[model samples]
Target chain A: MFDVLTRILRTGICSEPLPRIETEQAANLQQRIWAVLGRALCIRQVDAGSCNGCELELHALNNPYYNLEGAGIKFVASPRHADLLLVTGPVSVNMEEALLRAYEAVPHPKLVVALGDCAACGGIFGESYATRGGVSRVLPVDRVVNGCPPAPPDILRAILEAAQGKRQALAAATAT
Target chain B: MAEFNATPDFSGAFANAGALPSNVPCRLIETSREQWLRVAEALRAAEGMLLALWGHDERDGGQGFLVYASYLTAQGLLVARLCLRNGDERFPSLARLFPCAVRMERALHDLLGVASDQDDERGWLRHFGWPREFFPLRGENRLQTSFPPTPEPYPFVSVEGEGVHEIAVGPIHAGIIEPGHFRFSVVGEKVLRLEERLGYTHKGAAKRFQTLSLAAGHRLAARLCGDSSVAYAWAYCAALEALSATVVPPRALWLRALALEHERLANHLGDLGALGNDAGFAVGLTQFSRLKEDLLRLNQAALGARYLFNFVQPGGVECDLDPKWATDLPRFYSHLDTELEQMRSIYDEHAGLQDRFRGAGVLSTATARRLGALGLAARASAIPLDLRVDYAIAPYDRMRTKIVTQDAGDVAARVVVRFQECLEAMRLCQRLLEQLPSGDIHSAPRVAPSGALATGIIEGWRGPVMVALQAGPSQSIRHCHVHDPSWQNWPLLEYAILGNIVPDFPLINKSFNLAYSGQDG
Candidate 1:
């Protein structure tokens, strides 16, 4: 127990301050994030058929440095609990049905973020007999983070943007 | 009867007929249909492990279809090719000798119209989108096609008993991970049998290779499994280099080694943390994750990418090690050593972590050997088949690679191996950095001789990542088969989980952490 404490003390807190995403919506995100998602944001990641580059970076968000959970966002096991679907990969034909089922399972006012170059636009494994291009080809993707795999900070930014964008869209519909 | 003696002889072609003591591998041996059976029996007796078994259509060349099997023995590597005429696409089965060949043969049936005489003909990679008659790899099929969905469910083997029930998981898992299905037959909490249905991530990499130039194929190869980007890229490059007869600069070779070691370190660190998290130890996750992040940060600062995707190319590595990297790399190495040591001791001493780790999902050495387990998992089970040490491929010949093994073959053993390997990787990187040669870090690229075949096998973090490249006309690729070590290790995961509780499945699975997209190719 003493050793654990010592190790923890030595490691210190590694989490950096939240990234400054340069956008009109992101500038006001800090003030309204809590209001938009109530208490926390729950994301369900569906890997359509990635090489797993994006998934690794997504996982990094949970580490002490990114501390995604500390910032009131966590990944859930079921799509039923999710406010957004964090999808990756180029959407292989084998995974198309399951992806749709997961998309359907998410509750109303859902946000979908395609998480890599493959999900945004089939990066290397393009539109083939096996792949259906990207996530947009199947479902309505609101945002796309485009690197071979965008960095963790970029992903965190996208998540915040997606949440804020969806909340505003719902408001617009009600006013109309 | 002249069997493959394994003394690799490399001339203009990979001459398998002659016997010579050479390090250059993928020694090609063309055998008759009848001779292939004899060769399989001989290789089995000689304790030669089948590295890869892939089938390709040669109808474009006015020949029939051909199946190639590459074997690694104590002597060297031998690639045996067997031909089947147009209509006669049947070949003898090697599943009796190497049980790992079952999945390969099944995939061969789906891709090319060739099959071994094995009873289990259930389609492995052929899902609803593929028609029964359409062989996608027959040189004339349009790959822009995906068939309509069919109403057929996969026949997963069931354990029928009084209390036997089933738990089905994923083509899309709950975790932020790759897709593959796992069917566990359990009685209450204890699992009786576990059968996996992979190939869900199959994006037809073999077919994609045909459309690429030999130079550009490494980009696709690097993403075979993004985690082992260095391994797949290196394998593809090595094969391309051999075919084109380009000797990479000594500095480039050293840099490649450095990148490969860093890749190994990054994966081991991540797996250790994930294993700890699985065992309900959050502290382990934090420390190791922090370590991995720091390493990746260094990679971005040095190699221009966090994942090292385009860092390794055909003739050599992409960028030379800058002076800033030379200083910062050593600093990072020392930091990793001290932090990793503290975490290793904590994991070793923690009774709760040990309790969950030890004796859970034990894959015996016998079972591992029989199933042809490779790389980290095989090493965990006390099988000393590291290609770096045994095959002495390139820079490994100079690094004085050490083989680390554990007797227990459980999750604990795998963890121990990971911890020790992380340190070993640091040691190797330090050596490569210290003795980094002063020369060009790349070579001039050239078109490979058409129809010439060769194999490049690298001891990747997971296992031996093998690339068998048969060049086409001009700069194009004829047939490229990329083989991941997960092919051998995934079957062993099924055996490892038997008799263990279903709750412990994730822990054991993380310990092995086999690749889906990599093996799907």
Candidate 2:
């Protein structure tokens, strides 16, 4: 216990600071959402159909470097309790209905962020005999983080952008 | 004792089994369909491990469907091929002799329209995604783009009793994990039975493989399972290299081994921490996750990819480690060693953690062997089978790997195995870096002749991952079967959770951490 405490003290707030949003519109929207929600955002992650590369990056958000929870963002177990839905991978045909049901279960005005290349434009495993393409094929995705597996910072930015209602601008910027 | 040669004559064992000269790790034998069961039985009786069973369509060439099963024996690897005459897709099922062949046979039936004579003919990989007539891997089926609407619910065997309540958990889980359905028949937290219905993540990987050249297939193979990307890529590359008779440089082989050990290290550290967190200790999760992140960042800086996906390619690796990074790797290991030692001490001293870990989910040795438990799970149960030692290839043959085992076969045993393996992997990385050779990193890609077959097997962190490759015209993949250790280990989880409380399921499951995507593909 002493070792852990001392180690934390030595490290002294090592979490990476949030990257600056280029657009004034995105910045203002983020500030407004923080003001309205008082800095707390609950997210529920759904794996529509993934190779688990995206999931690994998402899990790193909880690590000390990202410290997503320290920034008042928490991952919840149920979509009913979540304000945002984070979906990963191209929507497999078997998971299409389940993804839709999860979207329906979340409360109204739910923001959905698609993480990774697979969830963005179906990446390599495109619309095929077994897949229904990206998350947009099943749910209305507000933002799409691009990468085979997006880095933790990219994923964090997408979540924040989704919460701030600047998902369109975020998606447009990432698309290039 | 019989002398074990690299390639032995199987003609003496079976009358009609004709040996074919193929560029594979195993000796290829062509036999009639009637002789398949006899050969399989003979191999099993010789204590051969059934590595993979798959089938492919040959109707375009008028050769009908071909079923192949590969086995590993003391005499080395042996692959038996049998043709279903005149486009008749039915073949005798080897599942009766080898229980591990059950799912593979069903998968062949589902994807390739190959029929097995097994009693249980239910679709394995076909999870209502495509129509019954549309076999995805066959050359005839056109790939559909749209979604299937509201497929029928899978049939889970019902347990009718007075306090028998059923709990259905996910194709969408509560945690940030892959999608897999688990049905539990429980009476007040004590699980009577657990049935896993996976294949929700099936993306028709085999069909996709058929569309790519052998070089592009390595990328798809790496993505088959994220955590074991190195293993899959290396195995795929090995298979291609063997088929084309391309010898990878000694330095490239050493670097591949280093990358593989690093992959194992990252996964083991993450799993150890996750297991601790599942046992209700947040300290393990925090410390271990931090360690894992640091390692991943290091990997990113050194190898250009955090997951090491595109590093291993056909003939050789894509990137080579520079001298500076090579020297710094050992320093990184020392730092990690100190931190891991501290964490191990804490885990050992904590009584609550031990109570939750020990004896929670006990898988007896008898049950493990009977169910074909594999990799770390099998080692934890004293099975003592590791492909690195049993089927050594390249660098692994020179570097003697220490096999760790625990006879208890419980959660504690699994944890200990991970810790020990992590240390061993660290040692291996250090040795590989120290003995780093200066040579060309990759050899030129060689075009394999058409109608060639090769097999590559690697002991991935989870267990032995096997890739069987068959070349087609213009260097395209005719049929590539990527088999995960989960194919043999997933069934054992049902028995492992027989009497454990439902709450401990997460911890026990994390210990094994079988890949749903790998198995689904």
Candidate 3:
């Protein structure tokens, strides 16, 4: 009865942003709170030639757990409308040309976020003849989020950071 | 052997299509451009779709290189081989006959520096970043150099109108995803055209196959696309097994089907969650994602790899379902059923999800068939070609499946098919577990008999994955091609996104869910 009542209460409360706020506070610092709450961002995604593991996590951002739009960020289908380009995969041979073309297509004032180890410097799949090691080889990267395919929460945090433009500074200043 | 009497007289049928001279028995048809059209027409009469088209450097007594085309028929396989001498690279383009032929020709041009009058000048598969004139697959030019130089400006087509600004997304995405370029010509909220440029995930796995032993080759297949490892491995093994004529044990066959369906279920679960989230339905996403995670955990526990790598080897399976899987499967099914019902309600009752999914990214049956869309997308759009059904392979044939379909071929129909297939898969898993047979898990696969060729097709989670293997001068892999259905459907994604609002592209893309890694290879 308590679980049922809690679920009903929770579902109702979800519409008001409290549950998401509760979850967001745990993952982000108090200073970063306004970063997520204040802005709705359009994301542009790039893939050098990833294994699609990162895609799985990217797909998760839209799921109820991360509900990025609920947090005020949206994934715009094209780069011209995008505020950020999220990159996954190590750049591969066939994709090198296409990747650069896509980067050039996006409008100015756009932020670039590298989403995985492959994007950073050629994760496990880097050594193959098909890849060029990392996405940075193909395009400029402003922020790096490391993981095989970072968890949905981590991706959401990266987007939030891009939206706020605050968390990357912390990582850089801390020198971690 | 009386089997010798069954061989058809190629002189009468393919003689006009460039049947080679008597001395060149190893070489088949050297089809001319005019002959390619005739050959395609003839093969169409035999009911075969053009599987793939690509070039290989000349080897052994074989001259310059060969361009190959494959046709599938109920009786057996038919291959049309066109030899392209190094300097004389011109060949008739089959793109006019088969729409999917355009991209294959472009890939040939990009990789081998080979061109044909049939080439699609739209640059469907050309490199935008790499040196423009330098072809990667030409054997003499294997060295990586910075000089050939990428094209200075990519020439993607744009739409011009008031409020029509172009939006380009990716080669690099913010999320952990494979690289592909999505160019949207949009007017405020409305999308006029969506052009997708992929092939960033190309690993040259097909080219590397020549160096790999059959055992190691399976590893390469599994890595072609990570998520569909089992399907790729199975397809590769199937080609090798058919070439070798190895008879796999029945129990192993059943288990293979079970694993394939399990793979299908895992992807569908994850997709369902994502699709829901695309609709702005958080509750559905949360529930389905939790469900998908549970399924992944189950996969990790059952197979050493969550994606079921190396579990499938040529001739038989590498691992058996543990005793725990048999026991735990029922409970898992029940859990899945409960969660599925919950999701169904959310999808059914929710108004927003319907608005996003109903008619968005619609790919009609005609368009899907014309584009050669394979797998569930094709099936959902009413293209009744399931390898398990059409080919009637073991386990799938015996354990009948009511093919799930929806003619709408829109995003909603895809979701409906996916959701329905999930339920059916769960039921099938339950049945397979109950009817589990007792037998050895592995079998000794056959070594190829000399001068044999075979093709294997498996309906992977994504679509029909076809792998063709031909035995070379010494029973080695002479030439091979791995065909992902993405080859057919990725082009269709451009059409599906047309007229959809820009914001709906993700929902549309996720609905088709083609793989860049597999297709690029």
Candidate 4:
């Protein structure tokens, strides 16, 4: 316990900035997220046949530097409880059905973010005997984070953008 | 123990043993189908572990189909090539001798149409989407762009007798990890059996390799398994270099070692943190994760990418070490060394962690040996089957690598190995960066001639990642077989889970953390 306290004290808080509450862009992020989701954002990450480059970045979001949960955004176990479906990979045929099921299970007015080059646009493993090519082919994606895997900051920005986009879509629907 | 160090004694029906172009001495035997089983039998008797088994369609070259079985023996590396004539596509299965060959044979059948004469005809990589008629690897077949997936019932051997219930977990798991299904048969919380149905992430990496040039293929190999990206990239580069007989600059080799060690350190730190989290220790995750992030930041500063993807290239590294890394890396390492020691003591004295870790999910050395998981998986179980030590090449050959071994084959032992290996890797990395040779970081790219065959085997974080490349005419790749050590160790997890509770499954699984993408392809 003494060792733990000493270490913790030395470490201090490592969470980078909550920027305008964020990478790539962070303006009006925290307020926008709160106004939209009310309390927090629940993401269900679906790896639709990724090289796992994107997955590593996604995991990094939880690390102290990114502190995704600290920003009131967290990954849930089930799609049923999720507001956003964060998908990665080129959507292999084997994973196609699973991706669709997860998409369908997510509560309505859901936002989808394609998290890597492969997920955004069949990065390398293009249309072949196995892969179906990109997340947009099967699901409606609001934001596509590009890179071999867009850095964690970029991933967070994509997530925030996805939430903002969904809230706008919801507002437009109600106004109409 | 010394027997494993000796090259395989292939003394029987196969007298003609030639060598393949590789950093390590690898004898090759291309013989008739009749001697296929005999070759495996010889190697098995000689205590050789099957390295990789792959079948490629060479009918375009006016020859019959060929299946190659690479084995790591006492001698070094030995590759056995089985030739199946045009009309005859059946070859005897190595599954009888090497149980690990079962999945390889099934996957070979799925990708290339060569049928392994094995009783377990169940599909390995083939879910309903891939029809039996369409063999993706065989370039001759005119395939439809998309095959709409259909459901096919997989026969998971059911457990019986009162109160034995089964739990099915998915291809879309609960975490930010690659997709694969897990079927757990349990009586209450006690797990009876754990059978994995992988290949959900088969992005046709092998099939896609056929479409890439000898130069562009390393990029794809790097992604074969994301976590072990550098190792795969280096292995692919090593194979291409071997085929072309390109002597990579000494500095380039040292830099490649730097990237590989960074990869090793990063993975170990990540896993150690996760293991702590799995054991309900939040502080472990926070501290180790912070340390990993620091290392990743250093990697980005030094190597250009956080994950070190595409950092290794054919005959060289993609980037030169940034000069600032000298003080920056050492400072980071010093901080890490101190922090790691503190964390280790905290973990060691924490009774809760010790109780959960001590006897949970044990895999015996004998079982690991019998099952042919003598490399990465066996290392923790007091078996030193490290490729860096056994088949030392390049920087590893020079660095006198420290191979950490633990007698207990439990999660605790694996954790211990990770901690020790991380420190050793740090020391090696420091040496590599400090004494980085004065020369070009890469050699001039030379195209490997057509029909050149070579294998590159490296000790990845998970286990040995082997890439076997057959050069096609004018820089085209005929076949590139990427073998992950996960193939041998994933099954070991099934044994590791037996008698352990279902609740502890995640911790055990995390400890081994087999690559689904690497093995699936």
Candidate 5:
């Protein structure tokens, strides 16, 4: 215990602050979110058909560097308790119905964030004999963070923006 | 040709038992339907491991359904192909002899409409969403079709007794993990039995492979399991190069080895940290996760992607290692070694953590062998089988790779094996960086002729990942089967969970860390 404590003291505060949102609108929207929820956000993640790559990055959000929970955004076990649904992968046919059920289970005004390229635009594994294209093809996605597997900061930003209800604006900005 | 030693007279059953296409290490034996079971039995008797079993539709020609099984032996690999004539879809099931053949046979039944004599006829890979009549991978139903949203409760096996209850978890799990259902039959937290139902992430990767060009197939292969992207891409490229009869540059082989080692290091670090966290040590999680992030950031800087996807292409790697990476990697390893040593000591000194880890999930060697467990899981059980050492292809053949094994077959054993492997991978990366040859990183591969078939087997971080490719006319892929070691290791998870408390399942499962997407694909 003494060793652990000394090690901690030596390491000092290695915890980095959450990354800043670049866009002014998204930053303003995150401030509005702070006003409404006061930094507490419960998220539930659903894997529609991902390759587990996105899940790896999502798990990294909990690391000391990103420390998503430190920002008061926690991933809950059940959809019923969540305020946001962070969906990944290109909705596989097998998981489409389950994704829908999860979306419906969440309370009203729940924000849905589509993560990774697969969830955004189907990525490489497009609508096929086994998939129903992207997450938008099945459920309404408020925010889309695009990357094969988006970096943790990008995912965190998208979650914050979605909580602020700036998904449409964020999408419009990315479009331009 | 090596003389036939142990068999039920191969000369009578096979039309041709010699001369496989380029790059396939196995000898192709075309067999009649009657001779299929006898050959499979003889091979199993000789202790040959059933590597893969897949089906192909040859109805366009006069032949009906073609089924092939590849077996790995000490001598080498042997592939047996059985042809079922028109109107005959059933074949003798090898699952009765080799228990691992059950899932693969079921997959063939789902994709190509082939029937195994001993099959339960229940849906395996094909979920309720897919129509029963439509066989997706067959030539006739190759095109995309709209699937109806049919949500059916899977028929999980039930255990009935006084106070014997069943706990069902997932398709969607609590933590940020892949989707798979686990049905545990427990008597007050002591697990009686555990059954895993996967395939929630099946994305028609095999069917999609048929639509892609040989070059594009590598991208799809890399995505088959994202964590082992480099291994899968290398295997795909190896298969393509073999089909095209193209030899990758020496420098390319060394670079590929370096990337593979980095992947191994990153995954092992992540798993070690997760295991520590599961044992109630958050310090391990924080430290290891930070280290993993640093490694990923290094990968992004050097390879252009955090996961190193699409960095390995046909005939060689897609890009050369940056000179900066060459300088930074050795320095990074030196720093990592010191920190990792301190962390290891901390973990060792923690009595509570050791108690949680030592004997939690014990998979005996007998059980692991019976279930055909592969990769780190197998190594933990003292099954000394590693493709890099046994198969020894390209750079691995030259490197003095050390095979690590632990006899305990428990969570502690798995942890130790992972630590040893991570250290070895670090040493390997340093070696590859220092001894990298001077040459081209890529060579433009020639187009493979139609009907060409090749196989690539790489010892990925998890285990031996196998890719078998058959080229169509005009350089398109006719079929590509990407097999992950998870297929062999997943069954062992059920056995590992037995008698352990429900809470420790995550820790045990993370120790194995089988890829759901790879298996579902």
Candidate 6:
């Protein structure tokens, strides 16, 4: 609930009277902040063994139109330098232990966002003889961006949400 | 014929290798379960590479479970089916010959409740949180949650040294990638050895397929590996048609080829961009990504799905090409020509990318052959194992093809192979489109027999995709294993990452771009 409230505040949803900065940012400065954050993020992606659909869209994120790097976000090669984990595929029996180890490899204060329905719910590989059906089965999932393979922008939104720490389910909320 | 586009020849290679007997009626030959070790040795001596090992638990009468070892020889493919009687379900392990066979054996044990008497003590496919002894692939009635207690940390091989530091990375990573664990034995930044622990996403796709109809199973096949949707669908349908002795109309075959070429082009474009990004060429990333997007948009216009899902069915394709795009392809071809040339120049000019990609992650021809590396990895390294030329499948048999090869056997070589294939695929697509005949898109296939089994192999972008289907009593699928080339490559990746610095691992990995779900399935 608190996180929800925070998100609302971040979006300037609850500021009825509206602070000057909030209104201005909400009205016309969204792109400015996005541009700033875009250049600042360095992303890392994990396949866990997906069919390459989500990775395709993730590839599309770098297309001239979205120009993910122009926004300032770059796809890093190693988890050591990464801020987020982009996981695709339904977790499989062969990959479960590997997934956990990779999660532990990333430094502290890292984010994990499951991309596509397979990573979110195992998608079509669900109930198969060889898979666990979702990324959450192997690790504590932070946010799930669902689609067969989610559109690139939706993936960007999920990453943005994680960067802002909105995907964290707080202890207070859990305790309540 | 263009020298660059000239295909390689593999005639009489298998026969010369003596992998197959002079006369074998069926594609498969039966042998006792106990002969597995002897068969492995014999096949190895005969120059046959182990393709895959699959387990089936349908006890015919009291005859017990059947396990199959698929071997690819120079002449023709051969399968050795080993039958284990009901009470004795143990088989000798083949890990000694093929180091990768260990995991496939464990997968069979985990899914079918069978065990290898010679299996290494380390637990494999069962490491996922699934209940022990549940054996999800078995026809036995039981819930997945009701199996025995979970085992503690599985025993993985350990390396020890004074300067060797152990760097463990992911089943969940810090990137938008698949979950996999790699234990890197490193000194400073140089990696000595890398061991992978996967199976985090082990949904029982092969097992669940039993409940689906042939039509429904086609959908499952397409979903087996999302990026290789067309490949899986075609492979599965090909198996179905072959089993039913049904012939697909010429137009459907033409359409299937078209879908495949597009699929290949889309993936090559996307992977090229990712590879460029890995090498720190942001320009390459932007340019190639844009090109891929345009291609996918064209796909969306041609087929309903940008990824081309639900496009290929059992008998043929789900739909036909829009006449406009069919007519407008020349313009698309023009755009691709310009973009590819530009991208090629960027790659050629970028020294950093070349430095990182060229010598790094070199899987030599000897090692590649030992592991039976498939697809571009094999071709780029001079293994010369393309199914298009060797197996001579439908449209490919009728049409001319150039198998792109490079002897570098490194990241750069793999990238070069993909880029070159992009041009070849475009040419093939044009040939297919121009030659499409007028005919029905599909045909009603003959229903399968209860105990019958069939398999199909298609040359997907990643490499050879194999699908095995077994029919149950009610004509439902008994078991289906949608084997992706990743299974063969992931183990090789573990070896490829060795001797390179830890930081360069991602670029080496992206260069191959093996499918995660394909392996997980």
Q: Which stretches in model 1 have alpha-carbon errors above 4 Å?
A: A24-31, A173-176, B1-23
Ranking by DockQ: 1, 4, 5, 2, 6, 3
Worst 10 residues of 3 chain B by lDDT: B18-27
For model 4, residues B1-521, the per-residue Cα lDDT tens digits are 01121234445322347778877867777655656676788878878888799988878677778899998887778788876776677888888899999999999989888888899888888898867678888877633367767788899989997999999999888788889999999999999999999999998888888888999999999987889999999989888999999999999999988888889999999989999999999999988888888888878878998988889988898889767777888888888898888889999998899888988989998888878885556889888888888889978888888889999999999999998998998899888878889889988878798988998988888888899998998899988999999899988999999999988999999988889888887
Superposed by TM-score, candidate 2 places the C-alpha of residue B259 at a distance from the truth, in angstroms, of: 0.9
lDDT of each: 0.86, 0.83, 0.70, 0.85, 0.84, 0.71
Worst 10 residues of 4 chain B by lDDT: B1-10
TM-score of 1: 0.96
Runs off by more than 4 Å, candidate 6: A1-51, A68-115, A119-122, A126-146, A153-176, B1-26, B117-119, B141-151
**Candidate number that wins on DockQ, 5 or 6:** 5
Off by over 4 Å in 3: A1-46, A57-88, A93-130, A134-176, B1-35, B45-47, B72-77, B122-124, B143-149, B158-165, B449-452, B471-476
Candidate 2 ranges with C-alpha deviation above 4 Å:
A1-12, A24-32, A166-176, B1-25, B144-147
C-alpha DockQ for predicted model 1: 0.80
Better of 1 and 4 by lDDT: 1
Which pairs clash in the backbone of model 1? Answer: none
**B1-521 in candidate 1: lDDT tens per residue?**
12443433222122345332223444666777777777777777767888799988897677799999988777667777887876788999999999999999999999997989999888888787678788888988977876666747789998999999999988877687789999999999999999999998888899999889898999999987989999999989888888888888889889888899989999999989999999999899888899899999989888777998998887788998897777788888998898888898999999999999999989999999888889999999999878889888667889999999999999999999999999899999888888888989899977688887767878899999988887889888998999999999999999999889989998999999999999986
Among the numbered candidates, top lDDT falls to: 1
Q: Model 3, B30-115: lDDT tens per residue? A: 45445556667766655466666767766444587677776544433345767766467777787776788888888877777777
lDDT of 6 by residue, B1-521 (tens): 01111212223223322222111112555665445565677677776777778887757456688888877766556666777885677887887887667778877887787787664655565673566656777667432332222547765677788887788877655556655677888999999888887665556666668767765787878876777999898888876776666778888888888888889998898889888888776656656767778788788777767887688887778888777766788679767976687668667766777888889898898888788788877887887777777777778877788899999889989998998999999888887777778879887777776666677888899888877776666657767777788878887887778889999998998888776567766
Candidate 5, residues A5-59, lDDT tens digits: the string is: 8777876666676666655444465555566666567899999989989999998
Give the per-residue lDDT of model 5 (tens digit) for B1-521.
23333545643322235655433355677666656777777666776677789988888877888899887766556677888886689998988777888888888888889889874677777788788878987788854677785655567778889999989888888878888889999999889889888888989898989989997899999997989999999889888998898888999999888889889999999999999998888888888998998899888888777888878889888788878777898899988887788887888889988898899899999988877788899999999988888878778787889999999999999989988898889888888888889889989998898987888878899998888889999899988888888888888898998899999999999989899999899
User: RMSD per prediction, one decimal?
Assistant: 2.9, 4.2, 6.7, 3.2, 3.5, 9.2
- Candidate 3 per-residue lDDT, tens place, A1-176, comes to 34334444554422222122223452344335346334456677766676676777676566554566676667776677766777777777666665666677776655788888778887655544456778777677877889755766667666665555634453454586
